[model samples]
Target chain A: MTGLPMVVSAANLPARVRIHEVGARDGLQNEKTTVPTEVKAEFVRRLADAGLTTIEATSFVHPKWVPQLADAEQLFPLIADLRGVHLPVLVPNERGLDRALSLSATRVAVFASATESFAKANLNRTVDEALAMFEPVLARAKAEGVHVRGYLSMCFGDPWEGEVPVPQVVRVCKALLDMGCDELSLGDTIGVATPGHVTALLTALEEAGIPAAAVGVHFHDTYGQALANTYAALEHGVTTIDASAGGLGGCPYAKSATGNLATEDLVWMLQGLGIDTGVDLGRLVATSAWMAGQLGRPSPSRTVRALSHKEQ
Target chain B: MTGLPMVVSAANLPARVRIHEVGARDGLQNEKTTVPTEVKAEFVRRLADAGLTTIEATSFVHPKWVPQLADAEQLFPLIADLRGVHLPVLVPNERGLDRALSLSATRVAVFASATESFAKANLNRTVDEALAMFEPVLARAKAEGVHVRGYLSMCFGDPWEGEVPVPQVVRVCKALLDMGCDELSLGDTIGVATPGHVTALLTALEEAGIPAAAVGVHFHDTYGQALANTYAALEHGVTTIDASAGGLGGCPYAKSATGNLATEDLVWMLQGLGIDTGVDLGRLVATSAWMAGQLGRPSPSRTVRALSHKEQ
Candidate 1:
C-alpha cells in the first residue's frame, strides 16, 4: 500500500503474438493534413524503439490520390536504415510496384478489394481486373525475390454493394494466395463486420485450404467491432494482425469509418492473454501519447489515453 | 437494384439472447445530480416499452449512501405497474428487504464481494459477515417467495487487492447458490478484468457444478475489455447479461471505475451474431440520445454516440 504494490496471481500466457504495425500507411493516409517526411521517419524510428518488429513504412500509391504519403521514397530509406525492423510498403498497381522495386524494397504489399464493386470504387477496376493487374505485379515481385502481401479490402461488406458474399471473398483470397502472395490481409473496410462474420469467413477460408498463418485481419473501428473481430481471428490462430498506432486511420469510402484498431489497445489485450508481441506497453503508450499530441487529437485507443491521463 | 438491396453475407446467428437490462440501476447511479423519482419511473417504463423484459427498477439502499435512488419506494410502484416487465430491486440489508416487500416486489437482489478487501471497503464488513447478513434477508424473502438475485462483486479483479483468485470467486458463487439465490451476477466491480481471466473464472465456476444458466456477467468498460470479456462469457453459454443503457453508471465506491457495458453496443454485437435480444437497436439509440440530452453530456455507449452523430 505504501509503494507501488505488486500482486501476483499465477502467470501463464501464449508464447507469441505478432502485431503488423500499419501506422505509416493506414494511419497517415487518413490524416487531414499531410505529415512531413521527416516526421514520418521519426515516427517509424520511435516505433522501432518501442520494439515494433513489423513496421509498415509507407505506400507507393499515386501522390494525387493519397497525398499524405507523398514522401514514401524518402521515408522508406529512413526506416531501411533502422536495424531489426521489417519495413513494408503498400503498392496499389504496376506503377506502385515499380516505384517500390526502384527503391530496392525487400517487402511490398498489393491491396485490392474482395468485392467487385469495392474494387471498382476503391481501385477503379473490377475484382477480376484488379486481380489481373496484381497478377503481373506479384509475378515480377516474386521473380525479384521480394515478399508480397496481398490485401483484400471490403471482405465483409461493401459500401456500394451492401453485403458481400463470403464465397466472393474466398474467391479473391484464393486468387491472391495462388498468385504467390506470401500473406493475405482480409479487410473489414467499413468496420461493420462482427465476430460471427469473422468466424464464418475464416472458417470458410480454412476450408478452402488456406493456412491460418497465411492470413492477417485489417479492421476499422467504425462500428466498434474491430477489436472483437481481431480477437476472433486470434482465437483461430492468426499470427499477423494489422493495427495502427494511437488508433489512427479510417477508410475514405466508408462513411462511419473512424479509426483503425489501436496498437496500444491490441497490445493491452494480447499482454493480458500473455501473448508476447515483443513490444513494451509503457513505451507504446508513450509513443501514442506523443503522436496524439502532434495530431492535436485524442487516440481512439482507450488504454493508451487512460494510461496517459493516469500518468499525468 | 432497388428491391431489398441484397446483403449476401449475413451472420448465421444463434436464435435467442437474454438481455438483463440494468439501465435503471446502473445507468443513473453515476450522475452528479440526482434524477427525480418520476423521471426514473418514466425511464423504466420507456425501457420496458422498448421490449426490455428484465429491468432493474431501483436500489433499496439507504438514501445517505446512494442519494440517486432515494425514492426507491416511489419508483418501485410505478415500475411494478408496467405490464409484462420484470422489476428487480437491490436490497442491501433487512430494512431494504422490508421496503421492497412493502411494495410487493417481484424480484430482489443481494450484493456481496468475492475479495475480502473490496467486501470490507465497499460494504464495511468481511465477506462472511456480509453473507451472514444476507442469510436472514434470504430467509424472509424465501418465505415470501420473492426471486433473489445475488451480485458477486470483484469476481474478476479487485481495485484494493489486485488479482482475484478463481477459487475465491467460485466459493462466493457457491455460497450464493446454496443460499437459494435464483441467479448469480458476477460484477467486475473494477474494469481491470481481461477475457482470459473471465474465461478462466467461468470455466472454474462451471467445473465447480454451477450451471451456465444460473450465471450472469456484469462488466465495466473502464479498461475497454468489457465487450471482449462479455463475448468470452457468451462462449461459455451465459444467457443473461447486465448492461447499462448508453453505457451509463460507475461505482462511486471504486475510484476510477467507469460505466457498465453499453446496452446499445451489446445489442449490436448480439444482433450481429443473429441472437435476438427483443430490443430494437434504433429505439435503444434514441433512448440514450434522449437521456444524454437531459444530462447535458454525450452518451457513453460508443455505438449509440457514433450512430446518433451519423443520424444527424
Candidate 2:
C-alpha cells in the first residue's frame, strides 16, 4: 500500500516515515513504579515484533536519579540478540557511556536542553554548560563506533522562560551536530508547541545547513498539538518520528501533561495517508494493552482506548 | 494577531475561524443524567461570554428519546436576550421546528446520515427517507427567516457499514444544500476519519459545486484524529468548526468513542497559529473545568486538563 495516492493534496509528505520507539526508555522512565526487567525486555521485543526498526531499550542513568531504569544492564543484554532492530540506551555522561560500552551497546543517546531554565532544572547545568558536558560523550561514542542521538528539550516553550526564541534553539542544535551526533530530536518537553512553531524551528534548522533527514521530532500531547506538530514536521520532510507505545511517559515537570504521542495514533494517520511506517498497528495496539495491564491502569492513548474497546 | 504571520510556510491557512460551540445541545443530550435547566443556561451564558459567536443551545427531540435535554423550553428563554451571539437549536422535524419557532429561535439545525445504516439507526429512516423528512422542516425554517444548519453524520465511516464512500457523502451533502440548509456540518460520527478522508470528502463536495463556505466540520476524538482532521479541513479553507466545551457528548452507538473536540484544544492551536478565534482561552478553559465539576468527571480534553492544572 506504500506510495498509493490517498490524498494527492498531501503529496508533499514523505511516502514513508521512520518511527523511533521510545517506550521502554523514555516512556517507562517516568513511571512511578519500577517496571520489572523481564517486562521491559518483553515490551521491547513486542515493539520489535510489531516491525519497529528502532527501540530505545533503557537509560543508563544512575539508579539514584532514575531508579525505574536501573535494570538497564540486565534488560539490554536480554534484547541484544533481537535481529534487525536498533536498541539504543540513554547515556547522561561519560559514566553512563562507560556502562553502555561495558555491555557492548552499538547505539546510545545524550540529552541537552534548549532553554537555560530547563537546562538548569533538568540537568543542573546552564544551556552552554550542558552542551559542554555532552561534548566528550559524543566524541567518545564516535570513537567507539556507537551511534549518537542528541536530544534538545524545550525547543518550543519553557515553563519558566516562556516562549523560546528560534535562534537560540538553532545555536544549540548546531552545537550538537558539530559534536558528531548523527541525529537531533527536537523535544517539546512541556507539549506547548504548535504547528507554526514547528515550521519556524524546522525552517531555521534547514537554513542553518542541517538536512531534514538529520532531525526527528519528539512531542508530548499536553496541549493536544503533538500530531498536528508532527504533521507540520512531515510537511518539511522530517521522517524520523519519536513516539511511545500506549502514549507512555508523561512529563514529570508538567504534572497534567500527556505522554508522548501514541505510536498507534501516529500510525493510524500515516496508514490513512498511505504513508508506510512498516508497522502492524494491530500488534502494536495489543502490545500497549499488555503494557497497560502490567501498569495496573488504563493507557492514556485515545487510539488505544478506542481500538481496545472495539475489540471487546 | 489575526493576520500576523505565525509561520510564513503556514500562511495559506485562514486568518480567522468561526467556532460553533455545541456543548449545550449536542453535548448534554448524550449524558446519562439530566442537567438542571439553570446549569444549562449558565453554560450557554459562559460559552457566549467567552466570545463564541455561535452556540447550539438545545435540541427539540422528544423528551422520551433524550430525557437529558427535556428542559429545552425552560433553557431557551433564560438566554434568549443574549446579544452578539447565534443560538441555534436542533429541530428533528416539524414538531421540533414548531417548538423552536415558539421559542423565537432565529437559527436551527437538522441532521441526516450519510450511510443508510446510521440513518436507519439514528432517525428510523433510510438515507433518502431522512432527507425527505428534512425537506419540509428546512423549507418552513427558510420561510420563517430562520437560518438552517444541516448535520451529515457518519460521513467518514459507519459502525454497520464500514468506510462510507465519498460519493455517498457528497450526494447527501448536496441534498442538504438543495433543501436550503444555510450550512452543512460534516460529522465523523464514529471518529474514523483521517486527513486523507477529510481532503477527499471536501474535494468531492467542491466538485459537486458546494463551496467550502457552506460547510463546517464536526469531529469526535474517538481515535484521536479530531484535531488532525480539523487541520486538514482548515488547510482546504474550511472556516467554521463545531466543538464541544470540555469535550462533552460521547457517542452512544460507539460506546468507547470520545466527545467532540474540546473548544479549548482547538482554541489553543488557533491562538498559537496566530489565527483569530475571538475566544478567551483562559475563560474557555475555566468554563470547561466548571462543567467537568458538574459532570462529576475530569474532562478528556488535554488542553483543559493542562491549563486547569496551571491555574492551580
True contacts kept of each: 0.21, 0.45
Q: What is candidate 1's lDDT per residue for A1-312, written digit by digit as tens?
A: 111112212133335777899987889898776788888888889999999999998899989999999888887877788888888899988888899999888999998888877777787888899899889899999999999998888888777777788898899899999999999999988667778888888899999999778899998776567777777778777878989998777432233446788887777677777777899878887887788677766666666656776776
Clashes of each: 0, 0
Best by TM-score: 2
lDDT of 2 by residue, B1-312 (tens): 121113323668999999999999889887766789999999999999999999999999998888999888999999999999999999999999999999999999998999998888889999999899999898899999999999999988887777788998999999899889899999988777888789888989999999888999999888778888898898889999999998888532342657888888898888888888999988888898898888877777788888888778
TM-scores for candidates 1 onward, in order: 0.91, 0.96
- Candidate 1 regions exceeding 4 Å error are A1-14, A250-257, B1-15, B250-257
Model number with the top DockQ? 2
Top candidate (lDDT) = 2
Q: What docking grade applies to model 1?
A: acceptable
For candidate 1, what is the interface RMSD? 5.4
Worst 10 residues of 1 chain A by lDDT: A1-10
Q: Please give the TM-score that candidate 2 achieves against the real structure.
A: 0.96
All DockQ scores: 0.30, 0.46
| Tens-digit per-residue lDDT, A246-290, candidate 2 | 888863234385689989889888888888899988889899989
